[model samples]
Target: MSRGSLFQRAPIPEAKFQKTEDVTKERDADGKKRINQYVVGELLGQGTFGRVKLCHDTVTGNRYAMKVFRKQQLMRKKDFQNEGPGRGMSVTTALSKVYNEIEMMESYSCHPRCVNLVEVLEHQDSQKIYVVMTLGEVGSLLTYDECEGTYTAPVPGEWIPASSQSTQCSSRSSTSRGRSLAIPEPIAKCFIKDALEGIAHLHEHGIVHRDIKPDNFFITTQGRVLLGDFTVASKVDEHGRVRGTEGTYSFMPPECCTPTDESQEYSGHDGRAADMWALGVTVWVVLFGSLPFQKANLKELFESIAECQYRIPPDAPVSPEGLHFIQAVLVKDATNRLTAKDALAHPWVSTADFSQLPAYIEAALKVKEERAKKAAEDASVSGSSSFTGILRP
Candidate 1:
């Protein structure tokens, strides 16, 4: 295949033509910087190993998300080379965690419904690794609507800090000044289908997205959903033995953390069941704007997830189909948990005909007159309010 125009450059000055070869897409080791010819925009985010920034394709005049990793961080330990058997990340294996994350992101092979890893950039004042990806400005589908005078969209996932959420929400709005809207059911289903397709692709390729969550769930400004941040996924063998307990504690399937006790891995298990659990959680959040389970701390949160101790909030009404699917996927035993495919076929998801619902529901929910009115009332009740204040943003 021919290389994209992005790589075109003037010929080398020295006798290098003899060694001509296609600039193969490559991964990187830390401290070796790969400078992308692309012009980087604002910083999107930072990972333990590096940062993600917006970069412009100078030649094409298009935008892409660029993830830059500090080589200094990666060099202290070998990240990608997870050769030995071990438990938690040691100083020797800390970099390995970052490396595993990069591999997981790249494993998607540029799937439309999964964040694509374009190239790893090396050149910079400081050593960095860049993963180029299509821009997503609308941001998360599970937006938090702070009824407080601020009236700001809540960050998609609770795991992301409030400060981080605020920054992302502000940046996305500055990129385009509109509140991120809840997707239409048709579009929502399409996005879900696209994600399912991506998962199928990964499963076919022997990969699983262990850390599937709303923050990791990104949608383009045009309303397309895709999975991101697969920093904890692992390859699954045919027998299904879970390779490791490598997911967010709350999102992980119980069997994943303790396969021997669960006895669900007749042969083995990967992250599939756990991924479905997270997916179900994602669906619940989309429909009801909250987690089915809540806890004061991480330990309590993990316990709730492991015990399947959750309930649909009485105040927040959800469609019967939606509730049914949530119930099934929230099963504690990984063996009984609904697979993504099965959940896709679930009556609520599959039989859900958003079109058939009252046409007025859209206008009623979208207009948010009640929410707006209530907000103004609350603002009056309070001494100071962001809505009443000078709209600092």
Candidate 2:
């Protein structure tokens, strides 16, 4: 296979790239700072390792989401420890978590329903790793729901500070503005169809997305759903099994959570099947505005999932076809759960009326525009903060 042609390989320059005292500060993009290649905008999302910022490609003038991870913060004490003879710690092995995510993103970049990886840049001097991806202007599916103010907290009486509530609500509107409090069946079908295609591709490649949730599914301005966040994704073995139990508590498959004392014939479950269960929950949320097995606590949630006791609430407006689809995938027996390929062929998706979809899509678009307009108005009153200022001090 020819290199660069098959993939836009990130070149490791012979000469080192350096940064000044301020990681975001620039000094005349001469020869030293390529970080200036992309003009960083607002902070999109953040976590323990780094924050993703809305960015613009100077060359193409296209918008993108840039994740900048400070290498200094990523270093763990265990990374420097010696395990055994001839088995000393390696920096590469230590940071395999980040590298594995990069590899998976690159491999699936071309998949229609998978988020595209634009480029990966390393600023050695600043000890920062920058990952540029196709910006989802509308943001994650969860954000879309949040902006619409339709999502009900799983646990009643959940506390949210009033000071940040407006900011949080407004932030979601700026990105993906669709509020799917109760997404129309046709619109939900479209989202599910695209997501299943992506999941099918991942399974075909022996990858299991341990973390499958609405928050990890992004939407483009065009309303296409893109599966993302591969930090916890793992390649399953030939038997389609993986271990370690990592993912959102609400979305985790029963077997992937705390194992019960009852003895079973099987010691582990197929990772791919676990993903299917999560997909069921995601579909339910898209159609109903909340998770099927949501509970006041993690223990109860796990018990609900383990027993497969969730049902489409009587008040929820899900169609029979949609309920059937969720039932097929949320089976207690992992082996019986529908695969992505199987889910794609289900009636709710494969038999969807394309003509009827446009009306729902148009409705969703209208809701998005209305929400965005309101959010902008709110921002003007609150006074928006700059991206650099938020991160610097």
**Top of the candidates by lDDT:** 2
Model 2 C-alpha lDDT per residue in residues 143-200, reported as the tens digit of each score: 4233653443111111223332333234333332232234555566787888888898
CA lDDT, every prediction?
A: 0.53, 0.64
How many residue pairs collide in each prediction? 18, 3
What's the lDDT for candidate 1? 0.53
Candidate 1 lDDT score at position 323: 60
Error of 2 at 161 (Å): 35
Candidate 1 regions exceeding 4 Å error are 1-35, 75-94, 123-126, 143-190, 257-268, 351-393
Report the lDDT tens digits of candidate 1 across residue range 339-385: 66676676765654434223323333333345556767887789555
